[model samples]
Target: MLETVTSPTLLVSERRVRANLERMAARANRHGLALCPHFKTHQSLEVGAWCREYGIEEITVTSLRMARFFAAGGWQKIAIAMPFNPREIGELQVLSQRVELSLFLVDSKGAAKLAAELSAPLGYFIEVDAGYGRSGVSWRDHASVRSIIRAAGHHRFRGFYVHSGHTYDAKTIPEIAAVHQELLDRLGELQSAFSDLHPIMAIGDTPACSTQEEFRGIDRIGPGNFIYYDLTQVQLGSCGLGDIAACAAVPVVQHKGEEIIVHGGWVQLGKDSLHLPSGPTIYGRMVLLNQDGQWDTSRPMGTVTKLSQEHGTIHLPESLRAEVRVGDLVGVLPVHSCATVHGLRATGDTRFLA
Candidate 1:
């Protein structure tokens, strides 16, 4: 569909996205849970529309701007999936007016104070630090949790939310399932406490949602990475290479010595590092392209060997370099889908389906 697709062009596959979405959605449905997929990973209006096509009415986002984007795209229910930032209060208020905005409140007192000042009725979910130490109220800190909840003081409490980001490091499926259950059990206890006030429990991260089997008390599941199953997702056992929904379409600009250079540099794909056992300098992986626009496995090529601000160097066998020439388009797999998104511009920020 992308006729002019060339170097550094990021493309998402419709079939793979639909399949991954259906698989995850079915898993949640079987357990009677709602899938409120996170929108920050893809950040595409078209991908947002695909989420809706799969019956995802409620969604989660990492920023106020993202929430605004999806709301403008016609999604009426959205949750801002990060700690409250006072500076975005005006944008949040504007989004709240158009759609129901569910804000994350790690500090109950701070959220209550902010909520009181808002001009409209707002809902909130207390962010609990299940295992990830990023930003959340400690799961075991009951007194702090109670104090924070009390701080709400009649302000609407939506429910409890937790994102088990630590699951990304799991080397095995069993390990990932273990972390999923652990998160659910911790959130379940808090859910029992405020049984009548709020009724939804939101947990995200593709690794947990796509692999784990037991999702009993989770009222809603939010997974964004499934849209474009990246190399990270594949390494995490989330999906296979064919399941990758998004990829970078780049051109081979040169074939020097035993290295191949592509127009796609860190500026287009990002310098997301993956720490391998031997070392820690892999920027990304390359997908060999055939004449018919398919991946050629015979020529594995090389990894994204090095990256400067504007150049991407690939180290491979000298034989492969001779075959690839300038003006040839190649596909580079992303280590992290979110980091790849940072390379895109304003139009790249949101790609919609016609």
Candidate 2:
């Protein structure tokens, strides 16, 4: 039955996407903040249009390529999330001419110089590393920030942008709240130091923003994962299993000892793993299917116990494995829906969505 459907299309239900957008917008409005969702997660023009339906005109993208893609699609206010790459300065200039473009700068020296060179009227965000340890200037590094701002000289300094990706690891609501508050407090200090600068403290992530209390002092909240909450969101307490907006239909191709083999594997779903005590892990949880294209949580349809380049091995019970024959379509609940959908190049190829 599954053989009739083409592979690699990511299907997203319009209803789920809207529900997530409405909830986020309401939450932000309640707390006095604008919602500028990140487009890097899905990067779909169709989904981007969906965001506009909810009064979101401003957006954040991870690359200049994404900026070009959406700008041509009609987005006006855009903040390129990552630090500016020198190689892309020309593209940035072209994008700036079309829309209000903002660049992220971590250090004072490099950013100051770039701001001086930009041909168009550009905006700036102090990319503060609020304990995430990945990129950005440290919140405590006052000297570094002071230099960057001074270097900006005359450009529009739009305050700070911090992504607390570490919040994904928080075990409790209190933990998530604590990290969120700490990051905000750091931004608060910067806001005070640069009072003339209209501070737009921006933060992103589904767990920290959705699972915790109202986020204060944040001018804009960028939550991409909430649009398609997944199994990881459920485990992190950000969302329930019912909120997951995306899934893949894989073809069951074989049956081994207590296992049902499928063609869907790491490359299809992603090579993501859950942090199990035994050791590192790969693949995500699996969901069995019914004729209605919904979740059948009846049996351990497959453990997703193993995978290779193009094949996934599902460790299943003898009774269930016997029921699933070759060419059967099995729905998979992704560990992270964002990673799963980003892999799909088109929407028409996914059977579950159509």
Candidate 3:
């Protein structure tokens, strides 16, 4: 049933993509919040256009290059969620003139320096750590945050923004809600502390955004990975397999015992792994596809147990070995959608995205 496909390919279901976008947009609108989805997920101009169909004019991207790409693609407002890049000062200055550009600031001194360097007006947000253990001002670093907020005097201060990454560690919905409540409480305190400034809340990260039903005081939510929910999101209970919009199609090349080797590997999908319900840690789950190459949600065949640079070996049960064979095309759902697409864009063939 899969003889024509000659190489590894990432297949996206337009139906699921649109449905995900609309679902998030509606949810944000219901909560009276802005859904500026991160464009770093798909990075395709075509995908950007799909977002526009839902009346999403404001968007988020990781780098200045992506900001410019989407800006030229007709996105009216863009927030570069990453830290302000000194190397792209010139490009940042240019992008600000063309669109409403925003960046993340962690240091007061750095904020002042950027305000002085940027020729055009720009918006800025103080990066709040929110227990992510990554970049951002720690919730307890009130003194430093105050200094940065003051230093961002001339520049447009957007407010306190955070990537609710701690929710990623949560394995259940209750755990996700607990982390969300703590962040919300901290955000509330920030709002009151800076009452004179009246900053808006910008909370992001897909785990909390998708699982939690409430948004107490959030002004905007940017859940990037929800566009293509992956194995990790499923394990975290953010979404189901039916909600996963993308799949990788690889040509099966060998069968050693019960394992089926495919042409796709780490370069095709990222090295992210997840422990499945069946109690096996695998890079990606072997998914089934309909005749149209769309995802078949009925069942997953197995898991990609081992991966080399150009080969992935999936462990299938004896009952399903005959159902799949060498020279056939198999479907895989990556563990992390973000890393997978980035890998494809970074090292795959030029025609990979198409």
Candidate 4:
């Protein structure tokens, strides 16, 4: 089946992708929340267009380049999920003129400076740290959060936003709910303290959004990775193995005793991986594809033991290795789909599966 494909290709299961989108859309609709799926995962214009079919118009992006990419594709409502980049204000201004622009800011440092240079009306969401210890102003740091809000008073204030990325650390649905509860508690306090603003709340993280049945008061959700659940998401209990939508088809390049090397590597799949009890896994897990172009997960294919620039070493049980051979196409389920797509796109090593 892969006889015609010579290069490492990134494949998307439209069936799975659509299912993921529909499930999330229904969840958001139940609570009247906007499902602003982040486009940084599947950057393809085709995928973005498919999202529109699911009633998703609002979108989130990680960089200005991405904003322009999606903006050029006619995505009218876009929120730059990352802090405003002073370096690309020109591009941002271009997008603002063409589409509804929203920006995220973590501190008061550049808020006023950015506010003064806006070429268009913008909606600003102050990022609050939801005890994730990542970026954003601490939830307890009301002073900083308010300062950023005040500093960006020139814009149309949207509200407060929290990523809750730490939810990915959860091992079960209850753990995810626990993290989400903390986020809600933090948001509740911040909202009450600044009651005059009546700022809307926005939270997103696939683990929490997919596990929790309800979004009590969230105005919008920015779940991008859920469009292509990775192995990490499966382990976090955010999704099942079947929910994963993206995989890279790489050709077996060499065979060394117990290891089979493939043409895929960190350049094909991103470096985001987990060190499990088996050992330190680098890139992804290998899957054998069926005639229908889906992974035959009824049996495990192998796991990528090591990865480098353009090579991946798959270490499988001897029984599986003997069943597979060099020159064959091996499907690799990346650890992180977003980074994998970014790596594939960045290196121009990409193609779609039929």
User: Quick one: RMSD of model 4?
Assistant: 1.9
Backbone clash pairs for candidate 3 read none
User: Where is model 2 poorest over a 10-residue stretch in terms of lDDT?
Assistant: 345-354
Tens-place lDDT digits, model 2, residues 91-126:
788778899988898776667567667756689888
Per-candidate TM equals 0.91, 0.90, 0.94, 0.94
- Location of the lowest summed lDDT over 10 successive residues in candidate 4: 345-354
Q: Against the hidden true structure, what lDDT does model 1 obtain?
A: 0.77
Cα lDDT tens digits for candidate 3, 1-354: 334457787777788888888888888889999888888878878777888888777888898888888888877799999977677888788778879988999998888778778756688888888788899898778899888877766888878889988898888999999999999998888778877777878888998888777898899998899988888998899888788887888888998778889998898888988876677788988876566676576764677999889889999877778888777778888899887777766655212221
Could you tell me which residue pairs clash in candidate 2? 108-148
Given candidate 2, what's the lDDT at residue 239?
78
Task: For residue 192, give model 1's deviation from the true position in Å.
Answer: 2.9
| Candidate 1 lDDT, 1-354, residue by residue in tens | 333555466666677778888898889888888889888888777778778887889889998888878888898998899888877777777778889988888886586677577857788888889998889888787777677668766556777788889998797788898888888888888778767766588888899888878877788888888877787877778888778766666777887867788877778787787766677577777776654345543456577888886678877655566666677777677888777766854223222222
* Candidate number with the higher TM-score (2 or 4): 4
Show the colliding residue pairs in model 1.
Answer: none
lDDT of 3 at 347: 52
Query: On a 0 to 100 scale, what is the lDDT of residue 278 in model 2?
Result: 60
Model 4 CA deviation exceeding 4 Å by range:
278-282, 348-354
